[model samples]
Target: MGGESRIHNFGAGPAVLPLEVVTEVAESLPNMNDSGFGLMEVSHRSPAFQEVIDSAMGRMRRLLSVPDDYEVLFLQGGASTQFYMTALNLLSNGGAADFLVTGIWAKKALAEANRIGDGAAAWDDSSNGFKSVPGDGDYSVRDDAEYLHYTSNNTLFGTQFNHLPDSNGKPRVVDASSDICGAHLDVSKHDLIYAGAQKNLGPSGVTVVILSPWAASRGKEGLPTMLDYQTHISKGSMFNTPNTYGIFVLDKVLSWVERNGGLDGAIRRNQKKSGLIYDMLDGSDFWRPHAEVGSRSMMNVTWRLADEGLEDVFLSEAMDSGMGGLKGHRSVGGIRASLYNGCPVESVEALASFMAEFESRHG
Candidate 1:
């Protein structure tokens, strides 16, 4: 799949990775660091593997500018598991957490919290089909709430929070699974942030969690040894054998990000790539985007053609043109072009050219 014929991948998660990173991983697979053992075959506790995990976490801190008070954890179970873990750890004794339901993942996070204990939507936009973010007066925060939970980007709905919402001095927790390292964020403003590695980081088996010192202290006592964030933190994210190869790839990807000018460079490139598709959608009557103009996602550009039939034709033709993963999420049926940190300008331009030609032929 890393060969010259690789297609442009726009899948929402397990999305495209930097070609250079892929090549590096490919070369290391047969004999990593001249150890004569494939990365997958090595023991997680081995010194060589320990170096991989350590370098990965260190690079993550420097790239994201994580503070001294924060702890970075590499865990399994993806972002879904963190939904429950966040509530179990952060929601105070008999207190509720406020969730801002802007999209599918936020709703799922709220549901998971309710299943475990007390939680409520500070504001829910489900009634509006998640087409926009909340206006100034639309949502209110409770002073007594334990924390405010929100998803920074909605992969399915193709919407994103242009600005973090006000938590009214409460701890702000975010699920940034789809857009964590795609751009620079004010890490200090958030008490806890979690993201699955499949989208922008590395692969499916690893999840990255960044927790503030105060938040780490708030985890519920007597929890399972594995589910507890403190356990992983105290053990340096090796409480149990982690996804060694995934972390290895992640380290390489982070190194690529740093060498390519870090998060600032990623943001500029992402803006340019997504701009091509959004501009085409804006100028063409045949293609319509599902998201509101201001709330549109730079990571996943969701849009539709004139009708479902036309969308089918577009996807079929796009596949023939070497563009894959253009289908939309089931909940919101349309096209979603996920432009992650690794999606190159050339791929975006090719996709734009294809879109233009498709419109001219079928519009």
Candidate 2:
């Protein structure tokens, strides 16, 4: 999966990782850091394993410019789990939480909030088919709400919040699962941020939670040990056997990101990658982007062919040309090229070239 035969991966989650990280993981699988045991066999309590987790956390803090007051936890259960965790921990006693329903994930989060306690959709774009973010006047913050929850990027709809919604002096909880680390984000702006490792950080089985001091202080005491953020925070994300190998790979990936100039570097590369396909789409009458111009995502760029009949042909030909995972989500029947941080510029170029040739053949 590391050479020419490797199709340019554009899958949404559990997506591409830097080849260097993959190689390093492969090399270390048999014996990590000169230890006799494989990485998977190493005890999480051992010093060797501790070093891996520490380095991963340290690199993440540096890369995101996370403040000293923030607690970074490498918890299990992806962002989906976070939907309930956030509500359980933060939603005030009998107080409703406010949610901006921009896409499917946000809707799920809102539903979880309703089940956990009281919740309401402060703003929703479902009527518009989730094609765009709510305009400035379309939404308002609830002063009495416990916290505001929003999905920073809509992977399914291919829409992103270029500018975060105004939380209006309230604590903002962001589910940045897909677009985390893809740009220089002001981590201090939000009270809490959660992302699944499979998208841009590393592999599945781990979730990264960045909690500001304020957010950490609000956790409910009676919650189960595993569900409590404070539990992970106190133990330094070592409450149980952690995702040892996933953290190892994540450390390697973060090192790669740091070597490449951290978040700023990622922003430049992603912009270029997404821009290539977008420019092609904008210029061509054959391909049509689903997201609105101002709301398009830099990570997952989705589009469709003019003739639905040719969709199968395009996917088949793209696969023959060493391209993979261009099919969109089932909810949206078209194409989605997820250009996560690990995807190289070369792969985007190859994809762009393929799109051109495809359009030429089908036009």
Candidate 3:
């Protein structure tokens, strides 16, 4: 399929998947493991489905190097559900939370927490035009706060926190939806890490939650059964009907990552791919990158043409040439090329070449 098409995907979330992984899923969905029925028709209590979930969790642990202390949960809904769940579980006894406001998603998370009666402080970084990370001075981390929340990578802004900030003694919680499996990290520092599987793991609908058992044990009561983390964890994520198809695809993608080089291998490839694009952006003044240099994201590379009018021209020609998804978020009007793990190095090269040709003609 890569050979037959000139198109390369660069959307922020619900982004690209390995073409090989997609083909494998397509072949397996109809009759997974040669079972009499399709995966969708398989019962959750059945041994076949148990094997599926077990294998999926095992692969996740191996790929991410998840510790025994952390429980890998395949939960319903995307990262958005995590906003309320995190607040409900962590602040159950009643305490404030702190969030470093970097982009739309962080703001949304804080807003959700506020609605749940958890007071949240948005760390001030507006002075830098939202292009840089927040300093210690920008926030007053409360000793009474249950946890400190932040998005590891801002997909919309093209900014990322390569290293999570040290919060003294507070537990760190991260919504790594855009850059989770694409890199390696010390998961011990975080109380909980949740990422939707759509971007690099698999298709949309299911979200992966990795939590310290202590964090999992504090889930609040009085919530609906479906929203309770304890309920899902106890049921082995098979309570009621599951998003079997999404889990199936996730299993395949995990296999792909394992074969290609686990977490370290993924980080190496991502760094290499984004480095090529960043080098091009830095060398030519014809294009100006939006995010602060040091904080720029390896997953989402956003930039703008020197002349604003060239934006439309670039988008039109790139799509015509079969290189698309380069248009940035409407809120930030520019171009964003999301280089998720599944996206090959060759795609990045195609995009760079397209940019050079377009600029040469228009410059």
In the order shown, the candidates' Cα RMSDs to the true structure are: 1.1, 1.1, 1.7
* Model 3: per-residue Cα lDDT over 137-190, one tens digit each: 556677877788988888888888877676657888899888888965678888
lDDT of 3 at 62: 78
Which residue segments of model 3 deviate by more than 4 Å? 1-3, 135-138
- Please give the lDDT score for candidate 1: 0.89
Error of 3 at 352 (Å): 0.6
Alpha-carbon TM-score of each model against the true structure: 0.98, 0.98, 0.95
Q: Candidate 2 local accuracy as lDDT? A: 0.89
TM-score of 1: 0.98
Q: Per-residue alpha-carbon lDDT of model 2 for 166-191, expressed as tens digits? A: 87678899999998899556899988
Q: Rate the local accuracy (lDDT) of all candidates.
A: 0.89, 0.89, 0.83
Q: How close is candidate 3 to the true structure, as a TM-score?
A: 0.95
How big is the positional error of residue 151 in model 3, measured in Å on the Cα after superposition?
A: 0.3
Off by over 4 Å in 1: none
